[model samples]
Target chain A: MATALTRLPDERLAELLHGYRASSAGPRRRALLLALTIAFLVAVAAQVAEVDLPRLWEHAGAFFGYFDRITMLESGAGRVWADPAEWFWGWRKWGVLLLDTLLIAYVGTALGGLGGFLLAFCASANLVSNPWARGAARRFLEFCRTVPDIVFALIFVIAFGLGPVPGVLAIAIHSMGALGKLFSEVVENIDMKPVEGANAAGASWPAMVRFAVLPQVLANFISYALLRFEINVRQASVLGFVGAGGIGQDLIEAIRKFYYNDVAALLLLIIVTVMLIDLGTERLRHRLIGALESRA
Target chain B: MNRAVTLRDAAVAEMAGIAARHPQQFRAMPPARLRALALFLASTGLLVFGLWRLEFSPSRLVDGFGQLVHFLGLMIPPDPGTWSRTMLILRGLSETLAIALLGTLGAALLAFPLGFLAAWNTSVNRLVQFLSRRVLDSVRGIDALIWALIWVSVVGLGPFAGVLAILTSDIGTFGKLYSEAIEAADRKAVEGVTASGGGKLHGIRFGVLPAVLPVMAGHVLYMFESNTRSSTIIGIVGAGGIGLMLSEMIRTLEWGVVSFIVLLILVTVAVIDTISGRLRAALAGARAG
Candidate 1:
């Protein structure tokens, strides 16, 4: 049978292969079918949306012109290929703005990271050991996350008057919720042995937490904080809409004034800054985790 | 008695050593290093600059409380205006909900496979994982608002653009989240499937997906709640939602309309949040149970 099958031509062998194909069952195949149905619905939705592709084509030049102005392109390729100093000046302003944005995020994340760590410890089942206490902390985290950061910023702007303070506070609140949850999860995942050992040795709860759990999860906490800091940096750019201050204010101002060149410059700075931060965070996380694993 | 005293002294010394080793990482202070010193100075400088830039005066704050009171006085009664406009607002809200659902669904659909590929532990090859991870990074790195701005240009305005914005941004988010979940999954299950002669996809199907599905669902549902609010903002870009109306209200200084719209938005967000929370809890409970 094997020899006969081997003798078959490629196309004929493909035909013979049809019989061996697995019959689809279970939710996976159902999900595929459901996706196709959803795709059909989306097509209908697209029609209803009146996406205006023809109009876009008609207005393509104008749209492209807007982008050119925003990006400050003298020619199609010249914007990217321009002189270094000219590029440097353009890049410098953006770099400064980017730093301002990072400052906003860093302040916010630091405040939130501290708050979140405390809250997470309080919320942790092992640390708190009291269901009500844990529940309260958890609920607080939920509430913080439930409200959008922008809404929080808006409220803070109203309360504290508009500025980076509101922006920082908003991001901090968001970080607290996000990092609190992550920190709690990390706490839950810690090896029980050290905790048990500490407890058995008549160590106080605080001492156990400080010596055992903290040591175990400190790198994880830092990694999470770094990741959240990166996210807060992005969020800082977002909070400008509500009059919360940062480089986002410039982005909004550029849009308001139709200064497309400034917008492009600002956006380029943001992309580069965020990308660099992400790379740095990833490397730091790898180093920390690697060290921890080696220690283990 | 001497041995007992020695043991107590050793314990105290050991504890001091441990405290010195780990220091309270929760202090929220920069390290006492050059980098920390630089960062501290930078922060102080920024604080001064920001205070100056925003014209933040204590006197102004003291005076501003009166303005807050007056604003509060103006928003006294919650008004829904004409029935038709109210209906229009509700209709617009439903559109926003639809945008969130479809966008998140579409993003998760695409991201599911890509996320699996990106998961370092379970990927087919290093190249595939690296490429997929990079794609996820790029997707997530760009803010959703920026994605909306780009999509609005590409697809032209309306809910379609809004949906695309959410979809594109969420693809990045879901990819990162789902990949993390995949990485966090029990290796023993994968090992078990592999040991039983299962193929890679089979291992994923039998082992990985089952473990990560609940967590992925939780993330998706959370995104749904988030996207509802996001849908509002993307509408400000003329993607056809209540945000367009709200932005118009703000532009025209129609405080009455603005308040009404804001209240509506708040209600919608709060309601959706409750629903998503319940769904997430249910999903998590079922999975854990």
Candidate 2:
């Protein structure tokens, strides 16, 4: 078999199959064109919307105006930051605000993660088995996520009288919806053999879930929780707009006051924080999953 | 029967005894870990700062409720007065629809190829896939509102800014969705393409794209429907559309006008949702059939 006609001459093979296989280039080109058309439509729409890029360039100063009010970098008439000593202190203040934002995310994520884990079981179609239970849980999750975070923040702010309570509550609620759905999805796709075996052994529901279900998707749950944590941090940054508390308030103040430099600085801080969280989460996920797999 | 029950119980006890001989899970959590001091100082510190900064109090909330109810009262008997104003409302809502369409289409275009490159199984290298996926993540990590604010600042406020924001934000999302679809494509067809002396791109173009395009198109359509609601809000930031009118109405305490715009937005969203739902179902059916 290895030497069967030496697999024929390369030229012979090319000739044998020639014209039989259609060239994919036509479809490839068509796909590319489709993409280009999509882009073109978007550009035309952007034009119709009349964004006025040139005007944006002209009144760039207003951006600065909005910035200063949010950051409180300027006191009295005209811009300050002349005193180097005050400048250093302002940097410290910025750090504190950043930490405050992190704290809001931490609390929100931990509480939400815990709630999501339990709700997830009820939501999973495979686990629930009961059609009505699954439908009710799924609908509950939809209702939870449909209301935007800002809308939730506004409602919470009204209820709690502003501050971190509202921000935390809003993030927690949103997280429950988002995390619950993802968790249930993971649950649905997990191996059911162990669960079935446990059920056959006369184990109660709780015991079955504990012994059979969780071990399969625990890593996934952790991975999702970490991902949500990173998201919560970003969300925390914007909670201050509604006076829910966090560095977002400072950022908004800077924007409203037209402090462009401060805005730039705060943006830098946010970008760095996000990158760090992302990296840390990735590493933690790898470590946790690695250990889980090795143990199994 | 009584003897049979006794034998069953005796057998269970023997099985438990045998299982005890093969013990598992030896580790135990440390008691000191429970007693360890949990950090609350930072949380409290931030909470205090928040309280001070927002000037938030329970009494203020009570007071605000009255004002909220008063505003609600003012919104009663929404009068859709004058043909010109009615036309204006319709026009603003249409602009929003246009924004959603453009944004979804634009994102789909930019996302598909990049998504192909980002797919773990289809990609030429792990590095390219990883980098592209992260780029998509960052794009999706931030909310549409932030994008509107940034673009509004960059482009200087208008419907254009709103349009740009939705497109930019949706691109990242589309990339993530498209990549997942590509990853899930049947490997057999891809392998068949490869066996015919086709390169990676050839296989993807013929074998993968056809399989996933419908799903991707359905996703794009759904996004368009969702973005319509978002486009309304972006307009508040001077991006353009009904949001501008709504915000203006709110500011001027024209509750009637606000209610009219809100009703318009709800109706528009509901209609788009129905249409998109039908489109998605059709696409799925076509794929299955």
Candidate 3:
């Protein structure tokens, strides 16, 4: 094959060789480019973020030391398991706070889910004919979701005083925005045949939405709300740090006071609660979707 | 012929009578409707009870709204403080970005192997996969703020602590997401590699990794955007970032400065959102092309 190619023509051989080289070198060249870009980005990020290797090395021991302390029993105590009572000494108060956190999430999700349901139809471009109304609803939701719930909690804490009430409102507003967007997207993707049928029957916009759009998007809306609830639970826990009320306040206090065992205990409780919520919601969401599908 | 006509007439009359008797049957609510109605009523009751328990009275809400408006009024004409203060804010903003970038990158790098191990298809052992998944869940259950508080104690108060906080929390999240992505990868490519006499590792490297990289990169970019928000908030707990400044200003009731920082954050986040959106689209386009 080589002798035949050489016999054909010199220019043709050069062209074939160039074509083979180009094909072979394409991936290698792309890989090299990618690697170089990554290297440059990493170097810049390291400098800007102040990721000092020497400092990290020095503090590595201290980092593990803190974990060791958290796990350690009291000064004279033996193993952590031996002092179960001491470990979970503040269980009652923390438990109450955790319950409060869950309640906050529930109320917030309900309120937000309601708001989302109300606004989603108006926001959905496929449903709402008026450009202005759709734009307004979309912008409102964007503003709601854009500002972090923590900031909302901060503001509400100022207005409503330091309690779970502020946390509830904050979560509600943020969830409304998040769920609204999702719900609208669901509405937008619905089969328009039912909507057209409703319209043909001389149904008003609200009636059309109620009779047609709601049925189609209800399953998806619920699913998104459940997912948001999962997120709001996590958010509610942290809201307590800002005095909005939850177990987070206790967790932060334990850390600041050097209550190492309490910190560990509180963390475990929070982690367990969150995990349970996650699992429970996942199951509930799946079941709800399945039921909806079966019904449809 | 007369008998047949009478029989047909009788049958038509009987059908009409049945339809008239059960006129609403076709449009009637299903048997499950009752259960759905009960569930809705029960949920509404629960929601009302929760509101009452939380003391979320309408009057109180109205009153709070007034207060909120007053506070918002105070936030008008956001002041950037002095030039030095402006510089300080800029520096904090930069730190927040850096923290997000480095934390996300670190998490993606660390989670890659763990994700492979956690993936059901790729895991060497079922027990190992189960344990890895549980660990990710437990760790991820703790929010980044909590992680920040822990790291602050561990590494002392600084942006380093902030970075560590984001790193640890993101590791759990990225691990779970990456593993899911890995698990969802098409097996045909892997089978092809194996059919070509490649080993398992070679199959994964040449087949699985290529399929999942784009998805993983997308996740990483998204995480970077979110981590920016997280890094800001972690600072409020004193791990060190713009959040520390924000909380401090809020404590002093410096509404103007607080407003300024809030706007700064909003703008930064918006810009990041655009950039990440474009990058993702580009990446998707490249993959498709």
Candidate 4:
């Protein structure tokens, strides 16, 4: 085959390869127009966003400069790794707050996931016969998710007087909105055979849902909840910035006070915690989804 | 005929044999169900414990709910305060949109090259891919809010810091996502380019990019949608965006104004979602190549 292909002229081979991608000019024009539109929007964005190219060029060093400083130890011992003990002088306090962050995420995800699971049935068009009920549920979930969890945290901190309570509530509300939407979508796409079977058997609405829908959607619900849990952990870490509780308070303080080493340590801790949660949740989700797939 | 006197006897014998062989299966529930029950109970217990530790007692929760309800009551008939304040909110919202747009664009532009470095198929070597992927992963682990806070210290504040923050975190995300798309691109195109005596850059330009650009564009559109949300919150950290107006209103006990800003955000979000959804659909459906 190679000898046969080599027998062809160089010009012929080039033509064959080039012709493979030959097309009309219409798409190229469309793509060019798209590019021009994006470029125009970007120009307007630069003006509105106050993106001064010269300013950015001048102060860009400070960007990397901050990272450089954060890596340095408080004792002037080069980097954090050089003198790990001094760099992590406040690890004990941070560790406790880290635990608080984790707990807050745990409670938030649980409450949120539970709330979503229950409300999803109402929101799902296929499950709830009442249009008003489905619309109300859908709108509530949309409102919950639309409002940022941190914004909720800010308000709750004010109303509840600053603690993990506000943080958990914030996460829970946001998660419920997000997970509710996902769960309802999952329910809408389920096979209707079992549902019809149960209906024909004269099962009541609740019984039909319990027997037909729950089995089909339970694994998906758990998987979505686990994904939400991973996100909640990240949010929980930052809730303290609003005094809603967790390590975020200290983190903000460190950033504000120019405690570079401390900032570095806290960020590392937060990232590591989030990464760990992500890994665990990912594994659980895979197993749940994999088992469901195998079962089917 | 002599052995089986009736169908009922044969059925009973078969049932007994099956039950004896798989007794657990004959039980009311499977082992999997029991395990699921256990897992549920364990997680519930943990949640309860965590809530307790967070000081979420029933009384406190009730009290908190009451206060929140009162706050809601205070928010009745949303007010925009003075016309000037309303203008300020509008300006802030516009600024937030701009920040998201610029930051996302910047991140995409910057990440395009780094993506080639990180992708297993396009990198110069294994070491480069490994290092680039790890670097991207570490940077992405830090949320955009944290980046905003950090950038505030660097650039002192304003939309510049906010954009930088968004740009920083998004570069990590976009690079990783872009590289993944690159990896998923069909290799046959690249081989065809190579067979035609195309250079490395030529292969990537003519072979890989055409396949992955639309996918990357879809990802970029999604990123822009999410970044708009991030821009709002980053402003709360003292960067330039509508979040500063939001936090200010909330802190000053201006419930009406807070509700108004929130309503504005909700409307803006809905609008952006609709537009982005359409663009994404167009991108996916169009055969630009």
Candidate 5:
């Protein structure tokens, strides 16, 4: 570049030096074109989703207005803050329902976690040499997870009658499928050396898993199970919309009946509960992971 | 004694001598076994309490099994009623897809900037970052179904409400996820940009954003895949999608139609999952390249 520049005039050298910014224009134009394409796609999606600007604008007040109404208590009361007791008048009933939701999440997670642990071994390619059995197990887990838990709740509600039973069963089935896939993946990633040794020793299948697979995957499995429990608590709350169980039934009723204050109260309770569970489970999972790593 | 047997005997004897010297090594359970046992007992108690309070019994289980079989019998054909009904269900499926697409796209767009605000290293100020993080947490803490219900009450129902509901819920998730990804990015490139006399925004755009865009895009694609599932169910809350149709069919006791819709949903979601999986793989490949 020094030799080439020495051959050039000062005018040309200055021009070339100043021309660096112009080189960037190519990428700038390309970025603009890309942005335009994305904008076009976004517009198309908005149209397909039936986004109405005028309607949205017209209902803007109503949308925000609902929040105001929910925060409000009866006449003469400024808001939910005006009287906490009045806002949570049905706390006792809601509390019982909340407990029911927690129980459903607990039992359902336990049942599903056990089912997943058993099935994961069969589904893992490293563990099960039978292709057909592995494929069937994979497909079964997929089917369990693919269907929304609420749909399962609806079907179970019809089959088992309206109560927390269907809710628990729905959560169990969905969690089983979800956790089975995860557990199998964990099994697939384990150190195969221990498994090879166990096999060479003529250990039975169950014995091999207990000594080789379980020890390696137990920490990950427990962490995932605890995470699923946190999710299931939130899920159990929603199962009630189908009359399966949980506080969701009352929450739905409040929405339908336009009991704005009740809706706000119930939503607040649910949000707080979910956040608390998320925090608690997250700490436990980290601790479990730490213990596993230290042992290794 | 045979050579192999004598060798094995000597090894066993040595191991026994070692065990005698350090007995703890042969203990069956780990040091934390007591804690584990207590945890097991507590969980078992909770499970028993759950079953008792929820009124579960062996008789109920047996009856439920028979009733479930009867329901399966009703769904053997998996019919979708008439041709017109099939078309309606197909259209509902499309609406659900549209809602998921628009919602996820909107969320990705909104979260792109919010990511910078929420990320610790790139945030404008610590207080703003903290506040934004809390806002995103609370927003994400409320489930998408609840958002759909709330939006339904506001918008009076339809796909738009579903779109808004998904958009709102996903924004919080994407924001938190995007910030975490950003925070994990190497800061050397960003420092190089700033060292070259670039402003903070310039540094972020040229260094941080380019580095994390793939991870962020991958996350957005996964969110789209999951949102499709959420949109399918949000309709049950009257947010306007196949869920509303599903709930309606269930209400009218058209078990065949319900089964048919469920199958359609399963197939559609599987297809979406495959497509998004491919896109994410390609994105990763591009990043590697």
Candidate 6:
């Protein structure tokens, strides 16, 4: 390759080198431009958001200091484990509230999963021939998803008079939107052969869906629902801050009232619970997919 | 031998007849049939019991739903209130956007190095990788709202607190996601670079980064979209944003302002969604080409 390049005519070699230089320089120039643009955006955003470097520098210690305070032993106390009873004094109450949070997520996911399952068929363009119906379904799901679950909780809290019911309903609506979108996508990508077979046999729409679509999408639907459940658990805790009822009520109170140790304890419980749920659901989803694949 | 052959023929005929008569029933039961049935029943029971515990009465739902309809009716012709109030809301909206953008940028910057450390293939040591992974998981386990609450106390109320909250949460998320992207990167380029006597860092710079940059950019843009929603929520917790205005309006029963604010949020989110969607698509197309 080097000998062939050296034997080329001077003009041809000059042209080749020029092309090589331009090709290399092109990306470098583009990278520089992109970097400058991003830097400018960041600077403006920092100004608008009031993210002062000096302020952060001055207050950085306080952030760590707060965590230090949360971990500090109470006056006259020895260590974290020395007074387990004192540290976890509110454990029983917090445990109940945590359970309430989990239950709320469970019911909400189930209800929303059911709702999404029912709506997914209509929402899928491949399954639903009527463009109008599909469009309407898609729009409704979009609206449901566009509004944050917290906002829905606020509305429901007022209507339901502040309890887990509002939280459940809010989660259900949001999850329906989320799961419906996912389920429809799964439906759209399924094997068309079974659907065609069912249709050719003069099967009804419901029968065709049951025989063709459900069998294919059930595993995916369940996996998505499980993931939604994991997310909903976190949301449920946050909903409690809006008076929807859960451990978050206690958590926000602890923060507001500066119950430092209680805050730490509650955060620990929440973190541990969420992690456990995440692990369990991950295992379950894997098992579910494995079974489905093996069966297939 | 002839008698045995006759017996086998008779058995085969009997099986075919049964299968022809009951095609569906002839299929063997799935191994998971019993487990699936039990799971369904248990799940249904749990749902029912949970509904009861939560006091989800049908009559109550009907009654509350009626009130909700009335409440929604009052939301029509969403009022922007006085010009002064409108200005405040617009300012708040801008603050929310700034918070999201800055927070996402900060998180991405901070997570970049941490992601390399956390990636199994890139880490300097197994211990560092393990520790970084755990740190990411634990930090991410805590919700952004909780972080906001902590920051509000640490930095006092304002968009600064919201930005910090978003930054902290996104650091955990981006660290995990970016590391996964790096680990999934194609290794052939790295191998070629090494074969040419390139240093480890050079291999990463030329090989891994090129493969992962588009994906990382896509993830960051997606984070910005999500952080916008999160910033609004954190604002309600006194972290300072449009959410504070929203909560205040709701508390005062300012249905008009509440509806107006909700509409503003919805429109802003939709706009961001569209822009980010296009940008991500472009990135993906670029990667493909």
lDDT (0 to 1) per candidate: 0.77, 0.75, 0.87, 0.90, 0.91, 0.90
Interface RMSD of each: 4.3, 5.4, 1.7, 1.1, 1.4, 1.1
Against the true structure, what is each candidate's TM-score? Answer: 0.68, 0.64, 0.90, 0.92, 0.92, 0.92
Q: Give each prediction's DockQ, rounded to 2 decimals.
A: 0.20, 0.23, 0.56, 0.68, 0.71, 0.65
Native-referenced Cα lDDT, model 5:
0.91
The 10-residue segment of model 3 chain A with minimum total lDDT is: A1-10
Q: Which ten residues in a row have the lowest lDDT in candidate 6 chain A?
A: A1-10
The CAPRI class of candidate 6 is medium
Which scores higher on DockQ, 3 or 4?
4
Docking class of 3: medium
lDDT of 6 by residue, A1-296 (tens): 45433488889989999999989998899889999998998888788778877888899999999887887667657655577888898889999999999999999999999999999999998998899999999989987887888888888888888889999999999999999999999999999999999999999999999998898998899999999999999898889899988888999999999988898899989999999999999999999899888988
Winner on lDDT (2 vs 5): 5
- On DockQ, the candidate that comes out on top is 5
Tell me the tens digit of each residue's lDDT in model 2 across B1-289.
5998999989787886756774542225344333332324554465566545545466865775676677668778786567898888787877787788877776788887889878998877999999998878777756676677776766666676777789888988899899999999899998999998899889988999889889888888888877886787666557777776766665566768767776667567778889889978978897788
Q: Candidate 3 chain A vs. true chain A: TM-score?
A: 0.90
Ten-residue region with minimum lDDT total, candidate 3 chain B:
B23-32
* Candidate 6 segments whose C-alpha is farther than 4 A from its true place: A1-20, A76-79, B1-31
Give the poorly placed runs of model 2, Cα more than 4 Å off.
A1-48, A51-89, A114-137, A186-219, B1-92, B107-143, B169-232, B241-289
lDDT of 4 by residue, A14-131 (tens): 9987776566456678779988998999888777778777877776898788788899876676888898888899989999999998888889988998899899999998878899
lDDT per residue (tens digit) for residues B67-184 in model 3: 9888788889899779998998888888888789888999999999999989999998999999999999987999998888877776677787888889999999999999999999
Which segments of model 5 are wrong by more than 4 Å? A1-44, B7-19, B26-30
TM-score of chain A of each: 0.82, 0.77, 0.90, 0.89, 0.89, 0.92
